[model samples]
Target: MSAPYAIPRSHADWRAMAESQSFETRAFIDDAFVDAASGETFETINPATGKVLARVASCDAADAEVAVHHARAAFDRGDWSRIAPGRRKKLLLRLADLMETHKHELALLDTLDMGKPVSSSLGDMAGAIACLRYNAESIDKVYGEVAPTGEDSLGLVLREPLGVVASIVPWNFPLMMTAWKIAPALAAGNSVILKPSEKSPLSALRLAQLAKEAGLPQGVFQVLPGFGHTVGKALALSMDVNCLAFTGSTAVGKQLMQYAGQSNLKRVYLECGGKSPNIVFADCKDLDAVAENAAAAIFHNQGEVCIAGSRLLVENAIREDFIERVLKAAEGMQPGDPLNPDSFMGAIVDQTQYQRILGYIRQGVEEGAHLRSGGESVETCPGGLFISPTIFDNVTPEMVIGREEVFGPVLSVFGFDTEEEAIRMANDSLYGLAAGLWSQDIDRIMRVTRRLESGQVYVNNWAGGDMTVPFGGVKQSGNGRDKSMHSLQEYSELKTVWMSLTS
Candidate 1:
């Protein structure tokens, strides 16, 4: 049965109803939600309406140590790690079922905490469920290998799970990202200590409860909600943590790598930032579709995606027409309360991010780029963190707005005269997370796909994929993949067994 809170209505109705709702205090540890050790708490505000949704526990390094100790004890005792693979798989599948049952509540919590539109949060919740299920289904299927050897000798390769994993998930798509890391880690027989982003920790806390209800053993899945400087640093530096996975900015990813090296030399997997390119060729069949997709690519989730196609590389022949269409589409993107299912774009994550995006917009104009559509901050609601959908034409590849990740609804479009120039410009960024190509010609598609230096490439679309496909990046965009059987391998180590009959 669907959750009672899951209502069917237009975006407008959802927005109006959600604005009046109040949330409870949040903290999850050892299979229960509790207050911080220091008795300190913080408020999580809705950026769309600037209202406090929940008061969450504010933890520090001391709390992190407690969480880690529990995780280490659980792993050392082998309650989860020594469980049969088939049994572990069943537990994971049960968790997935529970997530489906409470989809509406989880989706609503996500929207209220992160300020993403309810529709988008619903989709994200669905994706998170799929991720957990996919990993669960693959748990028992992964097999060790036996290498061919001479007579009277045997050799076998085995995969073993790391003891305890520390997962640091970003604010954008908080629950989904956490599942991307935790599902596979747990399926592969590891205990996890998750540190959700301070900006949005409600869903993670709720997820801990759901996991417990779904039969996850105590300490097998623990959540430590706190600021990154203390709790995050503590997790990274803890010698007991066998593996560390993170999804955030490139700058922070580098820092985590350094911390990992300094501590236990633990295996680190990072999925970092990107300034992805969405290249549109003149030979594309539909300019209107390209323009619409371009707008959606940058504006979806308020442009908070690590793999957002913020850099638009267009052919000079149809550049003016394409920009006009893109601007028209941008104007139609209504930014309002996130609980509204009708609003495609919601508020920025917080006031700081709102001002940061505005600063970038102003910098683009000061750097001589043309403001094609929207740039200034929206004054609606007076306190909510909202920015108008912004598009910049006449932008160069070297502009700050073009190169750096604004992490808001900002698009920078650059024109190139030839295909060679277009590909060159598209590949001219330190980030190589994702890129898109719009072309009908088979040869052009193949050639561009081969030349473009990105981890994931899409043709005539943006951000559509199943859990089987790998997701990661190269260069400064960071290393490692998530959301596949490959992701489970990241949490495991390989061992070889050799036997000799000569003895």
Candidate 2:
């Protein structure tokens, strides 16, 4: 079937439609959009067009206190946190349905706010809706444990909601990341306060309106839009916030952890940055497929994904041929207007990200890595933040481009001689969020899968999965899982119940 909404074709059309759409810019509290306590505001711009979308309230520590107080009151008063699990599931399902109904609007907002391709944003919206619905359906199915005891005693375990949750999402996948955290938390019967990245906050505010329409109670879900250092730190340090979930850089994640310990000792769940490795063995059935997946992995969302396969590790025998094919595939991906459906790549989130990516490219040059494909920004599209797909070959494990998370359309290729060496190279990084392996040999694939230290591994493909599988990472990539039943446990607390009777 065709998509419900047609993609905007021209820059003029996009600007006309986007400028006419009214958006709310205040902090969401008690089921309403309101300004921050300090009345401070910041401008939200459309990265694709560089136009001001709205003036969002700049929430500070005081605004966070208000939001958290309302959330705590809602939780303690049994409005949401103390509700029946089944009812909470129903509400979550309704919320998902509402999101699905407005998928096109959310997709447009996402593209305008974050400068991702509209078609990709549409798909992400659908995935986010499905994720929420799936989590809601699973809420009532998760069961607690019953411990076996002596004949005279009985022990029962119950799962209860963790009171108030604070979620901080990144700019790359704004609405989807929000749903990733919001769905499970709400389904588990917890009231939440969300803080979206300052770079992109439009979709998050729109989500607040959708949540309200889904019949979520006042104070059950709140959104505070502002700089991370101000409002985000407040959420991290708030004693009333029982749990915190964040997706961003490792440096900020460490700061959040420290803040959690300093104030509340809250449970912090982080899905930090990653420099994922996509390994291609010489025995792969199709080099063309490997190259295609390689391009999509790095080029998708302009390479802002935390799990993007930025590090391409190929077998020494196929290094030359594979690089040629990958370069050919990358030529087809051109960064342009995000609103155009034909455009596979789009702008960076903002000017800061654009400059950051440029700086990294310059670093790759300075560090002596061979720039094989693209390494410069496009000057024709001056208004939009555009960077060509960059590939660095002959990259050692020690180079900055090979080690750090560039978070742009940058790929570093490293050649390995043997299976053991390939596995060693893949597991050498501190971040092990996700990895991919391309090979036709069953034995070698099995051996590599068992030895790889990543949390999620894709075999012969780029990205695939839904709410059925657990999504998380090992080591410095962060703790706790999202999606599936495993994610539900993060928002729930266990309680032991014992009963004895003598009649």
Candidate 3:
């Protein structure tokens, strides 16, 4: 279904929305919006204007204890877990409908809170809504299985919900990531406590209320908006939390796993950092298409994407021509005011990420990598955290910029002579999240894709997949899948029951 709200085209209109927009600044627990137990709050800033958006509740250990208590109680009481799959499906469907109705409001929250373009924020809303709907529809369709057994015996394999799930999501794609974690978890009848990134929690807070309105049971879903050191750690260390689903940096994912091992040995599913490689061969059918896709692979969402194709490996025969085309494409994506629907690129998520990206650019220059284009901040929007799409050429695989995940609109280009060399360079990193390959020869495509050490590979295109496919990574990128039917398994447990019918 199409988005129901009319997008505001002008900057003035969006500015007005920002001025009049009401925010949910409290924690959502036990079906109510309340302040943190310690009554502490933290400010969420709009990177575009460097202005305070709202003071969200800064939940700590005490607040996490309370939320987890309620969540466990709700799950044990079977308020939701014991409900019929059809009933859960209906409620989730209602929540999706509510989200669709408030699509513009939710989109505005992300735009104002984290500085993505309003248009892209709207697109995020659509994707989030679709994810919710897909999981909701799958609720009743998922069925148990009967195993082959002796004539007098019966064996049944059933999928059951884990008790309590703590979902820690990142700020880059706040609502979308939140939906990705919670939709299937909730659909499977698990009680969920969401810890959204302190930088972007408004959309998640609002989503909790919508879920409540959609008839989710008390404590079935909760939102705790706070820092990772306090609320997030508490949830991770809680013995009562049955599973933890997280999406963020690789370092944080490792920490969460440690916490899980130290506490309940709860299931930990993570989708973390990526420095995906986009390789273009000499036999590419269209240089222009590949260049355009290459620009978007790194520049989309200001390149805050975890699976962004930040490393470009082009065959030497076509490196010069392809690089020129890519530079022209990057030139068209200059940073602009996020509220303007015409704008493609927006401000960085916050000042911290902005500084982090700049540091990487400086490191690239200091390391002798050639800065081909855009390694400076844009001054068009004064006080805005905007960075130009930066490109660095002659980047050796060992350089810091080439190895680490900058997580910004920075592209590093490398030239390779042979297919083996391209594959080797692409797989040199610790991350194996996603990769892109541009080649016209079918045999070469099959041969190269099999050798790439990545979870997902896009051939002849970039980032070309949908909800039907699984999204996750290997190695340091983390061990979890987010979309499609496979993700449901992460939040569920399998059980076998045997019965003997000897009369």
Candidate 4:
């Protein structure tokens, strides 16, 4: 058998890589790196070691306005907004090329800033590159429409770029998520203002430079690094912005929609939080495989995933057996230094998130959920924001751990008696983002796939999808699809032209 995964790098190698990077901390505005208008900056602490990495520009309302004005001017100028679709495609592909060329640097930055395993960030770079290339290639292929018209008149339906789009993305998967939001917007010819979460801003800063290198025009793309309340709120409330697309918490997503209504009522699209459910039936072909997936679904990325399968619902016949296997698999998911390429898990994003996860663990205990394994913070990495991979058994839908999103390495497990009961329990949540089911019975597969109240569903697996599929959620999880041809429509508006041919 192959040896277990380990961080390939030595301590000296990691120390060198960490010390080699320049502490670049500036806002990308008007295609230039500049400080906040008020000259204020905030410390960007490394969650892995509780050390300050850099002092990033702390952009507030005024700085956000600066970015807005710049983007508006760029949009109104029509340089990128009215450029040939083929040309826009070329620029985006060039940016993707640059990103791929610097993949290692980008991956290291993400590992240092957000505390994700370096191995995973490398994978994220691949995804981000794919998203850019996919949107780039498709830009020129998508065509406008001609509506049904009488012989004497013409009705031409056109798709035009929405002017000055503001994209507010979260900390986890920062670079990839930013690419998902902006690639289509940029390809469709919109000037984009990106507000990356303050918790992890390094990759975004690097991305801005790459965009410039790839020939994106001044003000066509910008990055503002600041608190969500400041730059994030400003972006949503800006009258000059024609659209606001956000990916973060469901609570924050709702606030953005309100801000949109309060301001220009710009079109809003959101991909928000989820407490996804993963169900396994007794008839599975292999319980071992199910147990492996169940562990990975919740433990990957240290459970920072928005669609992490935090809820595990197993049929009563195999519930006890499955929990034992899941615990065994979760043993390999210990938190380690992010720079170690082999580490399966990394530090929590921050102290606030760390404490929040611990609070949920305590709540789970109070609610009488059995602590199968892992409950407290590990002392291995004393300064790191590290929480052990935790599992709570016998969880009910009403418990806080079962209902709310902890967004950490925590799993809540429940047992169901029937397939119908499992479906009911899975659908009985405030979220409808994604769900997974495992069963060899073809009829059961068909029935469960149709009944799960989520945007995406998985059978015999969890959280695997291509760039071409639509991904988003229903209900409080937020709205609008994020990938495939549907996302292209999100950045463009429909305009109909009429001509009187008989006159």
Q: Which parts of model 4 have CA positions greater than 4 angstroms off?
A: 1-12
Off by over 4 Å in 1: 1-26, 380-382
Ranking by lDDT: 3, 4, 2, 1
TM-score of each: 0.97, 0.96, 0.98, 0.97
Candidate 1 local lDDT, 1-503, one digit each (tens): 56546464776556555655545455566777777888888788888778787778888888888888888888888878988899998999988988898787788778888889888998999899999999999989999998999989999999988999999999989899999999999999999999999899888877887888889888999888888888899999999999999999999999999999999999999999999999998898888878999999999999999988899998899989999999988887858667677778888998888888989999999999998788977765557787888999999977899889999999999999988998889999999999999998889999999998999999889987899899999999888999888898998989999999786
Residue 162 accuracy (lDDT) in model 2: 92
User: Order of candidates by TM-score, top first?
Assistant: 3, 4, 1, 2
- RMSD of each predicted structure: 1.6, 2.1, 1.5, 3.4
Winner by lDDT between candidate 4 and candidate 1 = 4
Candidate 2 whole-model C-alpha lDDT, 0 to 1:
0.89
lDDT of 2 at 312: 98
By lDDT, the best candidate is 3
lDDT of each: 0.88, 0.89, 0.93, 0.91
Which stretches in model 3 have alpha-carbon errors above 4 Å?
Answer: 1-7
Pairs in steric clash, model 3: none
Enumerate residue pairs that collide in model 2: none
Clashing pairs in 4: 7-342
lDDT of 2 at 374: 87
Residue 32's lDDT in candidate 4 = 91
Off by over 4 Å in 2: 1-16
lDDT of 3 by residue, 137-210 (tens): 98889989999999999999999999999999999999999999999999999999999999899999999988
